[model samples]
Target: MKPPVLLTRDKFRESVFARDNHLCVLCGAPADDAHHIIERRLFQAPQEKGGYFVDNGASVCEPCHLRCEQTVVSCEEVRDACGIKRIVLPEHLYADQPYTKWGDPILANGQRIRGELFFDESVQKVLKQGKVLDLYTDLIRFPRTYHLPWSPGMNDDDKMMQSLAAFEGEEVVITTKWDGRNTTIYPDGRLHARSPDGRPHHSQAMVKSEAARFSFDIPPGWRVCGEDLYAKHSIAYDNLPSFFLGFQIWNERNECLSWDDTLEWFELLEINPVDVIWRGTFDEKTIRALPLPNPEGWEGYVLRLARSFSYGDYPRAVGKYVRADHNKLGVVHNWRTAKVTPNQLAEKS
Candidate 1:
């Protein structure tokens, strides 16, 4: 089938804004720009039309537009907000089928899809060729945690609100959200900072070296996800239980272990789990009224379902509340080459 005739750039922007009633789909502010869910470069013939389909565009304010560029607002989210059912692509682009690259669907914005989207074809090919490591390593990386309903700066939406309403009666576990690097450790002893590059953060070596002190037989694709609090980011901790504090565990099947199982494994593996701030049925007021850190060390809290859930359910299963000014300070200070300030541990009695 032939693709629709391409509209000029200005027409595309005008049509999208008009369709959205000149309102930002993210925040309800006056629209200032048109956003493309999928990059133009990913299209078969980007230069010709720049993939400017109205369905692929969203009207957003400048703040939301910047968030989209930074990928804080995911493409799938924009599509859901704008009521775009499916990305319309030219017929030529269809030959690629489900995914443009292994582990990447053509519909996804880069690799930051809100849910589990596709399997890695490259990993499957390698596994078929007897490369077991490829399957294990690629399967166990940390998944991104979404913001809670009350988290500052989030765009209000029905899905998240629905998730919040459903969460009201369920037992939930809340833990202190430490300010540090998100690191993952494999049973094979490989450590990685939260990055696509599969390399540890420069400030993470001290934490990784400390983790090397313990050993365990974690099943092939199970991963220990944690925070590396060795180097100061925005918050400086004078007394920390450990450099690497285990938070979540993901198995080969991409299931997040129950809180009980995670705690049990942390104890069995001699790992320090993050402090449990509260554990009970969900309460919106209590969570909201919780006092902020007095001296500015504490970042915030994370709430998760007490039971196990699949990786794809992360958006509904877990949510985080970071301090209002945390992102601002985090951006001003570059942790990559920032001075490493060792957090002092409490003296053993």
Candidate 2:
């Protein structure tokens, strides 16, 4: 067997970082090294055609890279241990590659600009002592608008209120915004948290039971996005009916269904849907005057156009309005803390 060819070029490292958005594909932390799924040595042989290709590479942090080198766990195990959904390489990197598992392209947003790179010289030095080296850059992901707590003096809030006024008469659906970790259930039964890294989120038995009962109802390539209220966040839902409350039913293309369709599917699956606060034209004054949905004071409300619409591969018709005092209770300490038994949390009840 010929020795595997190693990919030591800086450009190759940069490409790997860019593909992973500069975070550890397994843990969602800053990536310090690039790991080869197939050992680089295996490709060194003169007859081997598979050299250092982005198709088999993953941007990983130092700890994850060390775990990979230890050979004590499988790649999937390492990924789960680190809370990763899956190693997603940006589409552009694998455009001509034969691989099928490509990640959503990182689009430019206000939070992070696409194509920007953040290099850490110290991390690079640490990686040099390890088997996998040559990592130097970190790529950032595009940002999406998230629900924010209302602030009195913030000029942005004033601007947002003015902008929302335009939709005052447009029909919209207002769903009670729960204060909990955002989660998603894919058509394939995979559950993940809503984060830049798509970390795996564990649910309680009841939550899993409901998901299993409705798994068959989920169309292929569609996803159920919701809030995991298994644990209390800053807002405690002592009167909550269930641990999970689904809000959106999205299609394979990532476009959300209309309010009616979302409710229909939830009813069919017998899943608890987020409380509908209101259904009418966008009424900023009415929304502002509405009381919190729960005792903790509802986090806010989500406004979704009765009809579905997309903006450059994103859902643009949806927006959220939060109470200024929403975060007054302080931050939720336990966001994505998974159980010791990886699969036990979701065991069939």
- Which one is best on TM-score? 1
Clashes (N, CA, C under 3 Å) per candidate: 0, 11
In model 1, the Cα lDDT at residue 59 comes to 95
**lDDT of each prediction vs. the true structure?**
0.67, 0.54
Candidate 2 — which residues are off by over 4 angstroms?
1-103, 106-143, 146-162, 165-169, 201-206, 293-297, 311-315, 334-349
Judging by lDDT against the true structure, name the best candidate: 1
TM-score against native, each model: 0.61, 0.51
List the lowest-lDDT window of 10 residues for candidate 1. 100-109
Candidate 1 lDDT score at position 269:
85
lDDT of 1: 0.67
lDDT of 2 by residue, 212-257 (tens): 7677789886778787777666675555666778887876544568
Check candidate 1 and list the clashing pairs.
none
Q: How would you encode candidate 1's per-residue C-alpha lDDT over 1-349 as one tens digit per residue?
A: 4545467789989999989999999999999998876554344333334767787789999888767654456566888899887665432232333332122332322332122423335334433443222222253335556677677734332122234754768888988888888887777677777643454556667876866765356778678888888877777777788888889988776788999999998988888998888888888898778765442766788899899987645656788886667766654265556667677776676
